[model samples]
Target: MGDLYSELLVKRERTAKDSLVKYGLIVLTALAVFAGLFITPLLLIAAIILGIACYFVIPKTDVEYEYLFINGDFDIDMVMAKTKRKRVKSFKLSDADLAAPLNSHRMDYYNGNQKMKVLDFSSGNPEHKRYGVITRLDGDTCKIILEPDEKLAQAMKNSAPSKVFLD
Candidate 1:
C-alpha cells in the first residue's frame, strides 16, 4: 500500500490584536529613535538595536498553520510570513485518545475538561472545517484544534479507526 501522506496549510487572518502588536512595535521603535536623537547620543545604540530586532520580529506577527499527516504521525507547523517554518506540535494519531470533527459530540469531554490544555492551530473561525484531537503532552491532556482537508482526515481515520470520527 502507498504511504498515507497529506498536507494542509491554513492561513490565519490578521486579527486586530496582530495589527495592534505590529503597529505598537513600529511606534515604539520610532519613539526610541526620536528620543535618542533629541536627548542623548548614548540612546542611539539602543535605538538601533531595537530597530534591528523589530525588523526580524515583525514578520512573525503574520502566520499560517500547516498540518502534515504521514503514515500515522501528525505534525502541525507554524509558517511565519511565508518564510520561516517551525514545528509547533507533533503526535501519532494512534496515540490520540479521541479524534473527531470540531462540532462532534465526541470532543465534548475534552472541551469541557477543566484540566485539559487547549491549543488552537485553526483559523479561529467556525465557518472553516476543523478537527479536534485529544492527546497527552508532558503528562497533561492537551486538545489540539487544526484544519485538515479530506486526505488528511482519511489518513487519520485509517490510522486510528475506532478513535477517529468524521460524522
Candidate 2:
C-alpha cells in the first residue's frame, strides 16, 4: 500500500489575466506620482485607496479540487491548505464540474477502507488507467490539484456518498 498523501498532486487554481486591473491601477498611480503634476499626494492616496479596494473586490481565484464518484456525477471542495485558517466546503457539481481540463492532475482516493490508491491521469500507459478527479471544465483551462490537508482528505472520504449520480 502506498502512502495516500504522497501519491496525489494538487495544483492551486489561479488566474493571470484577472490581476491586470489591480496591477494596472498601481502602475498608473506610480506613473502619476513620478510625473510630479499638481496634487501628487491626492493622486497617490487615490491610487492607494483603489489598490486597497481592488484587493477585496477582486474575485478569489483559488484552486479547487473536483472528485467524481463511480456514478459519474462529481463534487468540488476548495483546497484550504494555503490559507492560515482553513475552511472547507463541499458542493454538488454539475456542468461546471471540470472548469479546467488542461491543468488537470492526479490525486489519491480512499474508499473509507485502509487501502489507498493514486489517481494518475497522466500515465501514458492506458492499461493501468486509475480513477481520479478530472475538472469538468469549459472556456478557459483552470488548474486543479488535490487538497493537501489530511483532515480534508478524511472528510472527503467520509462525506462522499456512494452512487454520486442521483439520477
- Candidate 2, lDDT over the whole model: 0.37
lDDT of each: 0.86, 0.37
Candidate 1 lDDT by residue in tens digits, 3-40: 88889899887889889888887888788889899998
Residue-pair clashes per candidate:
0, 11
Model 2 worst lDDT window (10 residues): 100-109
What root-mean-square deviation over C-alphas does model 2 reach? 12.3
Per-residue accuracy of model 2 over 18-136 as CA lDDT, tens digit each: 46755665677666665445655566666666667656544333433434332223334334334422223222323323222222231212233243322322322233322333332
